[model samples]
Target: MIPLLASLLLVTTRPAVSQVILVEKAYEYVQKKEFGKAREAIDLAAANESTALDARTWYLRGYIYKELYKANPATGGELRAAALEYLGKSAQLDTSLAYRKDGQAVTRYLVVTFYNEASGDLNRQAFDKALTGFRNYLQARSGEPPDNAYATALYYAGYTSLLMGNQSGARQYYEQALRLNYRNSSLYSDLTSIYEAAGQDSLAAGTIRAGRQQFPGDTVLRITEINLLLSQKNYRRVEAIVEEYLALYPANVEVMLVAGTVYERISQGDSLSRESYFNKRKEIYRRVLSTYPDNFSANYNLGITLYNRAVDLIKAQQYDLDIVLLYEILEKVSGLFREAKPYVEKAYRLSPGNLNAMRALEGIYYNLNEKEKSRQIRATINEMK
Candidate 1:
């Protein structure tokens, strides 16, 4: 009679003991990052109704699956699906617990994470997958997302459509994003390129013009406008733009370079005498030097200007003047040469077989009558060949 009663008590407590023990073990395994063991224990606890349906327990399952999905994304589709399932269950268990009133920030954060995961798929050119992920998030959300969220999602969707060669789809999405007050300069730039590619130059220009008004200080947009003018051979307009900007920002090196380049282009276009052209070139270089004494562009342009002057003097049988100008250039521009050498060497280091820098060095050495140094450089060039 005593043995029979003891057996009955053991049978009655077995289920309760198993449920508690499995849940405790699962928690311990999760703490240790032993995901496989944790998953196994959780599965066992989940099968037992007494432990499986707890809201916190389901939430932990979701968190674990989300982490696993992140660790190995290629094989994580099912895991992420499982996470969504468990999280949904948790929310169903307690609607108020899905997002806290005081910590509504966490909800926004999760929304952003969902968006980021979708965007990652977009970046990988998995347009269908990205769209599916985004749609899933939209469907799951109780209300409409904020303006920025809508804009970002639309922009990425447009960009992906563009990549997939669906210009109309891209345009639709871009318009949607724009409607949401999305004012991204890069998106505008991309749209301009797309319009231009489709042979809609007028639309491209108009888009860029609109973008310029929105982003008034964007130098890239200005440069884009300048390039457009150049491509159309509107030299006078480019010159006017340069002159206007130069008047506004006289000390800006980039503006100075642009102005100098415009002047050089004008000089080149005129089929004038070499002397007249060289004189104009000299004036441009002098103006550059006046503004930026130690500027790389100014110094380099000065060296080229002096070199041209020396060449003209030599052609006119003025050897003494030619030698004097060459000497002055070497003395005044030696620092420029040293400063530029590192950048040129870096290019050569990246592409060791490239002869452009070596050839430039050879010319400089040859001009200086350093035949032995030129020969050494030539030997390295030959080895590369």
Candidate 2:
């Protein structure tokens, strides 16, 4: 009877084996900074039926995995993801809020990781993964007030979505960022382009106008507004706006090109004022060439303009006029051709393969009585055929 009682006491005094013991072991290993061992113990605890539902088990597992990720970032994406999962589980299971605060703090850290990874993914052209990572960052930051960082993330999300060909999604993110006062000028420009591509011209115009209001000195926005007015055939408004832009940006080459084209377009319609506008067009092209001597458009346009005027003069010449008068007219036509020669020759040198320049050069040589050069150009044209 004594042996039986002793045996029974021994058995009763010993602790029963439970899955919670694994969780306790994990915590002990964590205290010693032995995260590898802690991870093994906590994973077992998390897999067991009894401790799997225990909040302490999940919290310890989350902490262990998070530590592993911190130790080895190069191989830690899966580890960090695991940590987030378990931490979320712990927060969900802990009705008493025992791990809620710590879980949230850890989540904020993980959110930074998500954002960093998203930026890397974006640089690598991993559009789908980048989009997901950005959303994860934003979701983690939900309920936060709109700030510069938040707005910047929104812009990135929109940019990523645009790269993914998700136009509607991009529009939503951009609009949200706009409401938060995102200060990037590209945000407005990109959104405007999207609206215009969707055939929402009014919205495009409104967005660009808003962008110009916000960034009054933005050259791109100014040019975009000019183009929009041109599209609407609002020539009067376009001229007024272009003159204002020129006064502000006197040496802006792009604006000068636009101004020259505008003058040419106006001359085509206003017959009574055609010569005046044509002179303005030529003057603008000359100004561009003075600054950018090698500008192809300026060289080609000026040369062609002079060439066409000479041809028109030749066609309108009066053969019935007196010989002296005819000689004067011939001199004027020859003078115009002489003025056109060097420009067309320079244009031909700039783009040797351009058939228009080649043909123009041939005509210029023929008109200048350079029979050999004209024949050589004609032979080359025939050879190309």
Candidate 3:
């Protein structure tokens, strides 16, 4: 009877002693940064029937494995796979543990860390690894509602699909991300590009419009929407929009330039006489020139306007009048040409084989009736060939 009692006592006390030892060794390994050793201790503690079934033991085991996987230099897929396995076990063993103040915080931190690491893989252009990591992060947070990080994960996943050239997948994921939160401006840009690439210009324009409504003051979206309208020849609407923006910020040069171009387009489409239309064009160009003297389009258009006026005078056989206007143009616009020369010459110097600058110089000389200068420019253009 005495021997039997002794055997039962030893069996009972053995587990208690093993549990204490296991806990101590695990903590010691963790303090020493020996994550592998710490994981081993936790694994041992989790194997014995008496200690293995405890929630804290399983939680510690999961935490140790998570740290180990994070510290490992393995690929994102490998790390995520291992982390998912451990976190899955912990979640299953104790769902309530996640809501425990400290437990919830720790679990959230782990989830976020895993997500970011996976995102880094995606950023490195490792699409497959990133996909796996994102999947693992979602699985680990199985019962949670969509949070900011969750939304961001969906966005990145869509972008990864784009990088892989999977258009259908990209659309699905981007839509999912947007459904969660349409306030993401950068995601709108991506969606716009995707639709534009797919030849869905109307859809792209609508997306930009929606983005503008959501982010009223976003200059980039406003500009893109305006450009799309201009491309579609929706000039009246663009004119109205530009007028609104000009009212808000009157001295904006870019807005003024676009407004001028829109006016020129409208004038071209009018059923007006050349004399009437030419006068209108001259007024618009003058307005742009007055406001932005150094603007290239303004200077170039002013030159064209002078040439046109001279042509009109010549058509009436008013030679003296035309010559006097031409001389006045040369004197008044000399500084514009001089300023433009450096830009034209830079292009020429950069690509001596290019004909763009040579052609421009030739046109300028021809209009001025400088035959020697025109001949030199023509030779340069020929040599570029």
Candidate 4:
């Protein structure tokens, strides 16, 4: 009875456990590499009203979680996230800057996880989650962002926003990337397209021009600029740009074809300049054929141009024209048809199954008064039907 009374008396006199003691115990567990127990101790300290507001307690909690995460990263996503949160809180609450450096140092270890997780979310087409991940990555930079990594994240954020159909959000992110001097050429073109879609033509043009200045050798931007100018009926500017491109890349058959096609379209409406443009188009096609003798497009295009010119002459014959003038025009038309025959025939040979090339040859033969050739081509065309 005396032992029981004495035990009760000792219990009554015992001091309460301190919250700081739990923190110290957590630190001791961490020193022994018993991260799980350290986490439990720190969590208890954090939940106590007395220690929950302490900056050092939060920092210790963050540090302990970080060790747990490092031990087993594959299953430590929650641990990693919690560590970041606690560390950030420590930074905010630590007015004396006592834990700021350590907190930031720990934060740097977790930064790449945010970006990696965000990239995975992007690839999974989970756009909303991906955006949130990127935002977290930016925040996790801990106030000292590496320029290249920072710009890359911003650019992709814009790209993901675009995929989500959030053009306004995309533009904001893209503009930020641009201001940071992000080196990707697509950034300029994308911004220009956005501006154009919003009916901001001046801004679109300015963006494209700025992109061209920054990436002068970029073929995509050059082509994009040419297309924009062409849409504005700015033919002279289009010509100047094309000629400049050709001067730099004379062997670039693709741009040469584009130039010739553009000239052909321009001649369709500008009668006063029709003959000159056609001649220019013919010269470009000739250059292409010179380098690529068996090229189907150049052969077909040159033949068609001559054939159409002959047809145009015939269409212009007036009812009351002088007989000598009429004979001269007929002679000239026959000469043009003869000139078109070999090219059309070669084009037909290059693409033996092309109906258009067969038809063009048929027309050329009929125009040149070659009845036997015309009959043979006509029979082949009928057989295909």
The CA lDDT of each predicted structure is 0.67, 0.85, 0.68, 0.87
- In candidate 4, what are the lDDT values of residues 1-385, reduced to their tens digit? 5699899877764422567789899999989999889988999989987788889999999999888888887688899999988998888889999988888788877887778878999999999989987888877773775597888888988999999999999999899989888998989988888888898989999999999999999988888787777777788778888999999999888788879877977888689999999899889989999999899998888888889889999999999999999999999999888888888888999998889889989998888888899999999999999
Using lDDT as the measure, name the better of candidate 3 and candidate 4. Answer: 4
Local error of candidate 3 at 325, Å?
Answer: 14
Judge candidate 4 against the unseen true structure and give its global Cα lDDT, from 0 to 1. 0.87
Colliding residue pairs in candidate 2: none
Tell me, by lDDT, which candidate is best: 4
lDDT of 1 by residue, 1-385 (tens): 5699899999998997887788788778879988888888877777788876676567667666766776787677788778767766665665557432312332344456567778888878788878766756654453655467677777887777777788887887787777777988866777777777677889888988888899987766776676666666777898888777767776767766666666666666765754464565556656766765545555555445444444444444545567777666555444444434443444445555656667655655565566897798899988887
lDDT of 2 by residue, 108-227 (tens): 787788888889999999988888888988887886676787778889999999998988999999999999999988888889888887889999999998999999998888787777
Candidate with top TM-score is 2
What candidate 1 gets wrong by more than 4 Å, as runs, is 1-42, 45-60, 63-82, 88-146, 149-180, 190-200, 272-297, 301-385
Better of 3 and 4 by TM-score: 4
In candidate 3 the C-alpha lDDT for residue 27 amounts to 76
After aligning candidate 4 to the native by TM-score, how far in Å is the CA of 39 from where it should be?
1.9
Pairs with steric clashes in candidate 1: none
In each prediction, how many residue pairs overlap at the backbone (N, C-alpha, C within less than 3 A)?
Answer: 0, 0, 0, 0
> Between which residue pairs do clashes occur in model 3?
none
* Model 1 score (lDDT): 0.67
The TM-scores, one per candidate, come to 0.54, 0.71, 0.63, 0.64
Q: Is candidate 1 or candidate 4 better by TM-score?
A: 4
